[model samples]
Structures are given as structure tokens and as C-alpha cells.
Target: MLQIEDVLRDRGSRYAVSGGAVQGRAGADAFVAELKRVKKFAKATHNTWACVFSDLGPVKADDGEAGAGAVILKMLEREGLYDHIVVVTRWYGGVHLGGDRFAHVVTAVRAYFAALHSAQSR
Candidate 1:
């Protein structure tokens, strides 16, 4: 786990992105287990998540965020990250963010990737 947490502020919306690396490939059940392991995100309005494993390929859930899973999946594909799951928690600030929401998701995943790289370096 990389212990990544970042808050993205855009268009009056606050997105808290966090994630962990599972060390090995994880399937859908493992992804759900990971979500349950993160107690902090359980009560969030939306726990949008995505995970990719070398063998399992990729799987994601928008958690009602709509198209968020695809955004995360694209990032993972670009980075070539495997056996990792990222969760973005959103707190709506009473404003609509539109496409900016995807940007926030990217911001969150970027933070996670940075942390993951740092951890691997160490």
C-alpha cells in the first residue's frame, strides 16, 4: 500500500483520492475486500474505484460517479500499473463540476502513482 491521499478542489467540488497497491494481481473480490479494508472511505458519498491486475486485466466501478471508473482505468493503462486499486471519495460542494470531475479523478490517481513510485524507490 502506498498510503496516497490527496484533495482536489475544482468548481466547488472536493475530491479526496486515495489508494493502495496489492502487491499481486487482484480480482473483483479482492478489490471489494480492499474497499472494505479502507474504513475511512466506507461512508463517503461515492467510493469510485478501479483496479488492474496483470492476469485479471482491469475492473472498475463508478459507484454512481458515472464514467469515473473508465477514467481511472485509462490512467492505469497509461501508467501500466498492475495489482493496484485506487479509490476516489467525493464530497459534493453543491456545485456541478461536469468534465472537471474527471480531472479531479486524474489528480487523485496521479497522487497515488507518485506515492506508489516513491514507495517502490524506497
Candidate 2:
């Protein structure tokens, strides 16, 4: 699995993104579990994720942050990424970020793509 940790920070909140190849819903679930195995991720306030399989279409989970999963899913779809799972983790800072939270999610996912591209280019 590939991870882009600490993608962005704002208003005391921190964001990270992680992802890798997955087969289906079960694979996506396992990928999420694997991420949470990391101590910090396990303690995060929200762990939203989304994925698309050529065979299974799209799948997502908000993990308590409403619409977060859909936001990730839409980005993945726009990127034409398939058979992969991407997670956006946020550690809340005890303040409401409102719509800015969605923008953060997009930033995290974009960071993941950038990191992924960098890794593959190595």
C-alpha cells in the first residue's frame, strides 16, 4: 500500500491520504484495516475512503464525516482510477471547518496522486 501522510494541515486539523490496489469491497475493507493498524491512523477522528473496481463499480464509506466518501469517490472517478482504494484521514482539532473540510479532502487525494506518481516514476 502507498500512503501520503500529513498531506495538509489547517485550523489545527491534520489530513493524510493512503491507498493501493484492491480487488473489491472486501479488499477495500482490508486495505482500510491495514491503514488503521498504524497507531496514529487508528486514533484519527475520521477515516473516509472510496474505491472503484472494474468489476464492482464504486464503493465508499464516510466514516462519520458526512459526504467525505462521495467526495473521494468522485475524484477517483474523474481520474479514471480503478481497482484501487483511497482513504482520507482527518484528525479533528475541536473546531468546525464547514465546507473547507471537503476542500481538504480533495487536497489530500491530490497529494496521494502526486505521491503515487512520484513513487512510480522512481
Candidate 3:
């Protein structure tokens, strides 16, 4: 798995991103489960994620923060990433960020991609 922690900080909210190769829905679920096994992620306010499978198409979860899953899904589709799931976990800081939240999610996903690419290059 590739993880980029503290990818973004806006207002009082903090975001982290993670991703890994997965097979199908079960694989995605397992990946999420593994992520939540960490105490910090398990307590996060939201853990939005998305995946595009070559065989199964796209799957996503907002985990409470609405529309975030779609944002991640679109990024995966745009990048032509298949059989891989990307997660953006947010820790709310009691401020309603409105549209800024979506932008933050995008930044987090991009950070994940950068980290993944950097890892693969090594």
C-alpha cells in the first residue's frame, strides 16, 4: 500500500491519502479494512475511496462525506487506473468547509498519485 499522510490542511480539517492494487469489490473492502486497522484512520471523520476495475467497472464509498467518492472515482477514471483503490481520509476540525472539501479531496488523491509514482520509480 502507498500512503501519503497529512496531504492537506484546511481550516481545522486534515487529510491523508492511501492506495493499493486490488482485485475486486472484496479486495477493495479488504484494503479499506486494513487501513482502518490503524487507530488513527479508524477514528477519522470520513474515509472516502474509489476504485475502477477493468472487469467490474467502478466502485466507491463516501463513508459519510458526500460526493467525495465520486471525485476520487473520476480521478481514477481519468488516470485509467484499474484494479487499484484510492482512499482519502479526513479528520474534521468542526468547520463546515462546503465546496472546499471537494477540492481538498482532489488534492489528497493527487498527492497519493505523486507518492505512488515516486515509490514505483525507486
lDDT of 2 by residue, 16-120 (tens): 899999998888988999889999999999999999899989888999999999999999999899998999999999889999999999999998988888988
Best by lDDT: 3
Each prediction's TM-score against the native? 0.80, 0.96, 0.97
Error of 2 at 81 (Å): 0.6
Query: Candidate 3, 62: how far from true, in Å?
Result: 0.7
Model 2 segments beyond 4 Å from truth? none
| Alpha-carbon deviation at 87 in model 2, angstroms | 0.2
Better of 1 and 2 by lDDT: 2
RMSD (Cα, Å) for all candidates, in order, is 2.6, 0.9, 0.7
Error of 3 at 101 (Å): 0.4
Clash list (residue pairs), candidate 2: none
lDDT of 2: 0.93
Task: List runs of model 1 lying over 4 Å from the truth.
Answer: 23-40
lDDT of 3 by residue, 36-97 (tens): 99999999999999999999999999999999999999999999899999999999999999
Question: Where is model 3 more than 4 Å wrong at Cα?
Answer: none
